[model samples]
Target: MVVTRSETQTGAQTGAVQNSSEGWKQQPPYRTTEGDEGFEKKWTAHCHCGRVRYWLSRDGPLASKFCHCVDCQALHGAPFQWAAIFHKEDLRFESGAEGLAFYHAPDKSTTHRLPCKVSCAYCHAPIMDEGRNMVLMFPGIIKFSDAEHKKLFDPQCHIFYSQRVVDIHDGKPKWSKLDGKSELMKEVEREGSNTILGEPKNENMQD
Candidate 1:
């Protein structure tokens, strides 16, 4: 989710092309057959401006949730965060590798987040999330056509919702607790600086 200044410019330039590609990738009208057993597949989710991109391919996602944490609300500038959970190996990012950034809010919990915040770094659209298998992606970024949006996501529960400003009276279940761990943090520690993929050094900030 890290969005730096320069990535913004490149993202804007490629947005149109990416959006056009999105039109074709929209999920099917009806849910297609799930991938075969033992089958592996990959899907891509990109920042609106396209500078930051990722691929998700592993065994199907373990679970997905729409988060309504205050951090999520502020990050998204929207009602909640839409995220899918997958094994760490399921996610990968390409492009603007240097522009990938990190932030830790001392006022908030000790959680450090990937770039893309402060103002929508990519789309300037007011929604971003930390990157890690644990961080959620904006469903909007999946580039699924409108038809796909209807089928692929209908978040079953909302997490960290006690912090949500609006009451989620839609009968949707709300979860307000979190286990303290940052997936990216663990990944970086294990991989160290010279990661197979470029890995940014851990920033020394109070979480």
Candidate 2:
């Protein structure tokens, strides 16, 4: 899915809102590298206060990207949001969901939805975004062993680049809106500097 603002604002009610992560017990436990023959690589992530923790089963994320949408900028209080995509089943909570809190966009009362922003209740640190079939995890919270392991979450492209507050010079593709659904914007060369294809070069100049 595209994981747009509208989708996060009003996701279909799947069932009763889960109050705890007790249901996560049904999932298999993470494997260790000690003597287990079937030891699978896993990545552990925690909130600011360490009250909320989770594990990713896969070695790497299914997809990773930098989102420049206004919604993300406002919610994160940053220029962009870097997110790693993973199947809903790939994530598992450590202890329970007691320390986790959810924020439903548009309407906070609607909690029985698929798309919602998960955060640490105490520290108020944004964790991951839960979607219907996938979850957008924040790479910052993950504990990577080294620089190489961290590269697994590197963004492949910039989405919603048209809404970006700052221009990026990276050679990675920049999409006007959605990744594959929108236009692949060309990098315009102005005064020996590259800028967005259709944007005015002058900062204070009106379009």
Top lDDT: which candidate number? 2
Clashing pairs in 1: 1-115, 1-116, 2-115, 2-116, 3-115, 3-116, 11-49, 26-145
Error of 2 at 177 (Å): 0.9
* Residue-level lDDT tens digits of model 1 in 1-207: 332223232122212222234331232111122442432345665665666665655433455676655555555567666765544344445432223433333223222222223223445542234322233445566655567543555666655543444444445445443322221112123323343222223322232
Question: What alpha-carbon RMSD in Å does predicted model 1 have with respect to the real structure?
Answer: 16.4
TM-score of each: 0.49, 0.75
- Candidate 2, residue 123: the lDDT equals 94
lDDT of each: 0.41, 0.70
Model 1 alpha-carbon drift over 4 Å, by segment: 1-41, 107-133, 145-150, 176-207
**Residue-level lDDT tens digits of model 2 in 109-191:** 53423467878889989888776667789999999999999998999998877777677777788877777766777654435
| Global fold similarity of model 1 (TM-score) | 0.49
How high a TM-score does candidate 2 get?
A: 0.75
How far residue 165's Cα lies from its native spot in candidate 2, in Å, is: 0.6
Worst 10 contiguous positions by lDDT, candidate 2: 198-207
Best by TM-score: 2
